[model samples]
Target: MMNNGADLEQCKRLIETSLGWGDAATWTNEDFDTLSDRIFEKTSVRLSISTLKRIWGKVRYDSSPTTATLNALARYAGFEGWRDFMATTQPPAKPSPAHEAPPAPQKSPTRRFITPLIIITITFAVLISFISARIIHPPAANLPLRFDHRATSDELPNSVVFDYDATPMHPKTVMIQQAWDPKRREKVDPYGKQHTSIYYYPGYFRSKLIVDGELKMQSDVFIPTKGWKAIIIGDPLPIYLSAAETTLDSGRLSINAATLQAKTGSPVFNSKWTGFFDVHQFAGISGDHFLLRTTVRNTSTVEQCLCRNVSITVMGKLSAIIFPLTDRGCISDIGLYTGFTGVSGKDHDLSAFGCDFSQWQQIVCAQKDQTLDMWLNGRLIYTKPGNRSIGDIVGIRIGFEGTGEIKEATLQGGGVPQDLLKQP
Candidate 1:
């Protein structure tokens, strides 16, 4: 029951294990709050958010231990000390019909094996072999959790997952997909109600339908983690809307798990995401391709984060904010502007027919601060009123390299697919 090294290790281990980490590495109080929130979802522990954060602060650069902190965890774990606690690998059992009554227990001589543990004053100079070990090799219990994992692009034969960047999906009886764009959020009440004002702007070029001439715009795709992966679309729009899945408008793009790992902090070139996916020919673009150019947001928060063991659920309503592209693609490497950059070109090359060359109004969003210049054969045809935006673009492809980072994506209508982000 008294303070000891073993108890400290166990407390550290508890936190680490709860967060799916092998050891209790240095963490600020806020980090612990986030960690506990993640763990509490899967368990029925009545933990106050504030209390866990305080406990985290105790181990985070705490050179001195307080009596109150130790007593709290000891009581919560229903244990006398750290050593006695770490010994419980599984959760204790509950009432069962098989055991109508309990049997008497007896003690053995093995109890003498217990050893006294040492507790050193908090000091950077103290040996931290355990801490180092955790960072180097975390225990198996600490690995992150997953719902599912679909391996190959070929898995979506009959029904599709709407995962990668290709489409014309083999007509499936049913399909599921996951979609969580920050922009797609909406406000709802417990009884199921929503209230919001999220609008998508029109840019200059829609899909191949609006772009007139034969185009092969290359794209720069950014991967959150590097690995070989691909994206695919699953909606039966070709049948329902009688439109090509891809156009100058939107489509899907898939990346590899290996590709994700390799492009850490960088982006890759994906031709499929450059413009629209021709639903008619999309199925034939590539063997198991991945990429989708739907109404997706491409941006990230400037504030860096320190979150782990996190999951979000929306049993009620949600809300989101969307920034449409107007002026230019990007103001800088990370800033935002309307897609309005001016580059001199060889003038209009509108040879292909079914064209409306007179006006090139906004094809994307048309918010108030900026306007974008539509270019064909390098020449500007239409200049929509641009409203400066704060996020990147789902970008239109020209010769210059491009990249995409979804800032906000949401469902406008229809029963949104459920497998949009299911881990495969």
Candidate 2:
């Protein structure tokens, strides 16, 4: 019989193969970061980069992964959970006939089996006791669990106040998670009635109330941007920019490196990013059938930013459609999300999304009949087939590695054009 350690190793190997990113032994820190994002995207559970490194043996650690982490990994590997994966996994093959060992003389069965029998009896008795206890004291039928949230304002750096009541469950611990990322979770007093969390960015967030690791209730918390907001993406908080700070004239929206440096007080732009967001509900626009046309270009030179990457995101109620454009050499560092699933450039041929950033590039994304088609410079680059509708089109976000410009951004469906750049 294979041990739990061997099963875990097999699970890791399967995940690596599914990722199709070559070998885990050669993966870098950035690779692990990307993996972390992908796992969260798929499993809705965020695993810290350090925790992943330890699991992959990239970091030196003695403790094994927790059950929750194993469950997330199993789910990412297309299984229900760790238990399901173990149940369905096949054991190693027996030795071949030529290598088989000779049988030893059989002895009469004796007290040697008594210890195992006693252990089994004890386990059975414990299970029965647990079942009896559960039957005798069942959970509250009408517990009246309530969870809801309201945003304090309509802009970035917004605070959301959550009202919940998990008292009936009598859980030892209560946690309020801002969104899908568990890193945003915070412990709350079970007896308390309110908790507040600040959202530094605008998006459609699903706030959850968890009682003892079990999700008791959840609600949608949509924090829409006032209009076209520019910001330097930062940790814990972002540097917000006013219309005067970002250049929004002559049918163009952009922020230069100087503006970024002034706002962030930093000159280096290796991993820094700037984003333009219009995160409000677009009336009568369905995410399943819409057209987004934009002209974008990276303004930074190679010396300022090596990758010169740009990403366009169409935020939907359920999921978002995200695609990236980068310099030809940095294509391997990008990924695409088609509202249903995400694919990395490392395993897939995403060369079509790569282009020369010295000139303006036209990008068109259209979703119709549950299928998404991407066009670059009038050339079809990718076609993704989706099953379910991603609900209404909520917002649009344009991001740049260092500095970039959007000449035009328009979304249309049923032949009606909605200028995303217009002030609300």
Query: Which predicted model would earn the best lDDT?
Result: 2
User: What lDDT score belongs to each candidate, Candidate 1 first?
Assistant: 0.28, 0.84
RMSD of each: 23.7, 10.4
Tally clashes: model 2: 0
With candidate 1 superimposed using the best TM-score fit, by how many Å does residue 321's alpha carbon deviate from the native? 11
Q: What is the TM-score of each predicted model, taking all chains together?
A: 0.19, 0.70
Q: Which residue pairs of candidate 2 clash?
A: none
In the range 102-128, model 1's lDDT, one tens digit per residue, is: 775664555434322223333433557
For model 2, residues 1-424, the per-residue Cα lDDT tens digits are: 2355788899999989977999899997657877887677557889987899999989999877899999999888888899889888967689999999889767456655876788999999999998996676466665578899888887568888988988778778899988878788899998889999989888898888888666678899998888788888988678888888776668589988888778777776778899999998999898878888999999988888899899999998887889799999998999998775667897888999998998899988888777787888877788866535668989999999998999999887742123322314
Q: Can you tell me which runs of candidate 1 are displaced by over 4 Å?
A: 3-5, 17-25, 57-424
